[model samples]
Target: MDIPSNHSNHDALWLPFTANRQFRSTPRMLVSAHGMYYKDDRGHDVLDGCAGLWCVNAGHTRPRIVEAVQKTVATLDFAPAFQMGHPLAFEAADRVARLAPGNLNHVFFCNSGSEAGDSALKIALAYQRLRGEGTRTRLIGRERGYHGVGFGGISVGGISGNRKLYGTMLGGVDHLPHTLDLERNAFSRGQPEHGAELADALERIVTLHDASTIAAVIVEPMAGSTGVLPAPKGYLKRLRDICTKHGILLIFDEVITGFGRLGASFAAEKYGIVPDIMTVAKGITNGTVPMGANIVSDTVFDAFMQGPPEAIDLPHGYTYTAHPIACAAAIATLDTYAEEHLFERAAALTPYFEDAAHSLRGLPNVVDIRNEGLVAGIELAPRDAKTTRAYEIFDRAFHEGVLLRYTGDIVAVSPPLIVEKAEIDRIFETIGRLIRQVA
Candidate 1:
């Protein structure tokens, strides 16, 4: 492997989800990463607090995953996904399906969570039509839910900032009210005791839209990108019951919560609420290679299979649907998780992680703290009308030897599942100190 020389010009590349101009001015570049730490360009060892954007569950650069990618690329670099078959693709799909709950036994591979979102939506809409309910075209999502950036995802997604600039996205898309209730559930541990009735909003939406017109309701079991809002206790069960009653398919965008992030194989298993379709990525390949998948129940897959034997059941797919390298990485990643028992490790660490996170309750400008499993969110009060305090803390924390993620006024902490007790303590203590310094 050859390391490329450091390029002096940063203007050639535009970073995603970043203030590019601000980033170019004083760049914080990571040169390498391993285990729970990243080495930045300045030769500083930074603690990975957010697990590289909530991915990298088994930690970074594990030998098995790295070797798999290298060996697969050299042996079978690219395989056409449209018609050509590959043994690795089938094996990988089987592995992922076995981890999923219930009859979610079929897998559709794609390149990222964004593609998985669009793919899942298409599956729901097509499944409804195949079952002779073609009128079911409307899709539902919740406020502040982040479901990647595809047009289909954005239409169902409820973040105003992500939607406003994109113009009127897909029609017949509606959103349920968000579950974040600062006054009622602030600083609560695990799932908040209040706001369970928020799921009733789905019932209201069903009434307003007429259940016949709705195809699916997509949501994150534990909303991650919109600052880590865990589903209220009983909230998911109510949604599940309502969707089942109305004949609407339920989809869980578990890109952030899948693959042991919630101390279970997936949030569906953790909450015991199996969705009709589930989108997963990030941890699928341990963030080593880009891969996402839509795992559907047997009922949904069977509906599409009723057509002619030679016919293509679903017309949607990506060019890199089951890229050979990605399949190799995913298989190795799953192997790492099982061999190391990382999921059980994460479950054991949840209580300690939660306690460490809540220790910032008394810090200045700290408004609320919420957590579930291995993830947490520390929300800060706005300095003015703008929400830059969290970003400031994030920047300071990076310079002070910790890497964190900031969205709006909230900073998220989701370290690798392999993180130790001391590293967890260091992560929160750094944030606690930085919160005061920024204030």
Candidate 2:
């Protein structure tokens, strides 16, 4: 494979969630990737530590996914999603629904996690109206929660930087207090013991706004993008109870936690709590293709089914919703997961991954370490108020032949589920050595 020339024009694209100026000054480029590693421009083996931004659960460039995508693009590249259908689209929906928990038997397809978030929110609002509760238009989100970048997602999302420039988002949107407490739950493994009471903030929000006005409450079960803050023990179940008591739909934005990232098919299955509506993406097609979905329970799907025989039930979808190639990739991806027993493999590797992550404790500037399943976050005490330490570490790690992710002075390690124990050690070892050198 030929690497793009370093001297090539690099200003034509504006990268998302990246420092474009700094990247242009010194670009870290990858030419190719296979199982567990990426070949950089210089042809160095860079071990994947974040699984290509928390997707690619299976790993890079798997044979089945590649072949499926190739065959699909050749035969049928595009298909109209509105009032039309394809066999692969229906087949993909069936595969995803079978893996979902409970009676989450219906799937609405989209192109990315952002679209999935917006679609799930719209479905909740529409379901409420269809059930004769048109006044239930308010949406609730939690502090430090990350859904995606869509207008509805940003409105319900609580990341300050993601919301500050957008100005006042959708009206009647409220946020529950975040459950990240390093002081109380530092160095904890799996689910933290404290902060379960934080879920009661939902009840308070319900009292303040009244249950009749709320449509749904959306949250990330592990809060991956906000630096891997796993939910407190009993935290999710408490929220589920409150939402059930108040008749508000509970939406789990499982974009990052879906498809074996949490050692199970989804965070819902791992935690034994089923939300009314679930938005999923990322690993649905193993990051080989762009695809997402909103999986809803029978009750929610049935409500929309009643008022439509000849009429369109839902008046929303993207032009590429369930595109033929994406559907083919999804079906092949699900087949790969089942045939390889990757979910069970992830479950078995959790202990080794967790121990490797926690071994980095007591290192310089390391403040807190929290991990669950295969995902871990090592938060550093900031060198300055700007929180540049982790970014520095991330930059150094990439050039040092390992790739990692950083956000707000926190370094997160979530390798592909196919990673071996030795690869897991290498990821943490590189991260540890770099953290010491940064300060």
Candidate 3:
């Protein structure tokens, strides 16, 4: 493989989600990836503690997914999905629908998590309007939720930092108070025992806005980017009950939790809460190819089927919707997950992950620890004049042969499902040392 010629030319590339100038001076470069490690430009084998942004659920560079894309591009490089069809797309959608929750029988394809979220929101609103509930227009999100960076996503997303400088977002969006009770739930294992009442905040928002005005309430079943706050015990059930009674739609943004990340195929199944709609990306193609699905229940889907047989049902779709290559990639990814039983692997490894995560309990600056399945988060106390002790730990861990992710003061870890017990120990041990070093 040929490296890009402009090794020193950071000026030419405008990197996304990065501090461009700082990154140019101190760049982290990945030259290759294998199972559970990335070989950096300097040949350092850094263990993957975050599963390549929590998408490579089956580890990296699997032959099946690689071959599928190779075979697909050879046969058909592109297929116009507008008023046209392809077998791979149809087959992949069928496969995804079969695995998707409930009568989430319909699949609308897009390219990324942001697109999946925006598309799901649009589907909820459009379906409501089609059924003559046109007034149900407002979208309800929770504080601290990270629903991608698209216009519709940002509008509903409650991350003030992500939305503050973007100018006024889409109107009629409200947020339920976030469910982060660090005082009560700190260092608790798995789903914290407290804060189950947080779901009831939706009722307050609903009463204030009147349930009829809201099209859907979107949330991560376990908030990931806002620092891995798993939904409190029975909270998801309460949210479901409220949505059921109010005739409101509940949308789970399962982009991060989809596939085998949660030990179950989806967080919906793990929590046993059936949302009316769900948006998924990331693990769809093992993060090998970009793809997303806006999954709608049969009722919501049939709402669009009401008007006519030969007419266009939904007036929205991407030009690359159901791209053949993406479909091929998704199919092979599913095969890889099933053949290796990665979801069950995650379940089996949860206890080891939990122990390793909790081992950081006494480390300096380690304020709290959260763990679920193969994922863990260590919250760091702020350094003076800075709220980012975890960021320092992140950079330090990369240099110490481990890669970690940081959101604010929290360092998150979600190793590939294929991570072994020894690897798990290395992950937390390295993190523990890094935390002590920073403190």
Error of 1 at 210 (Å): 0.6
Top candidate on lDDT is 1
Question: How would you encode candidate 3's per-residue C-alpha lDDT over 49-152 as one tens digit per residue?
Answer: 99999898888999999999999999999999888999999899888888887778888899999998898899989977887889999999989998899999
Local accuracy of candidate 1 as per-residue lDDT tens digits, 130-173: 99999999999989999999999888998888989888899999
TM-score of model 2 (CA atoms): 0.97
Q: Write the per-residue lDDT of candidate 2 for residues 224-337, one digit (tens) a residue.
A: 999998999999999999999999999999999999998999999999999999999999998888999999999999998884499889999999999999999899889989
Model 2 ranges off by over 4 Å = 1-8, 385-387
Clash pairs detected, candidate 3: none
Model 1 bad stretches (over 4 Å): 1-8, 385-387
Which of the two, 2 or 3, has more lDDT? 2
Model 3: which ten-residue window has the lowest total lDDT?
Answer: 381-390
Taking all chains together, each candidate's TM-score versus the true structure is 0.97, 0.97, 0.97
For model 3 the local lDDT of residue 194 reads 92
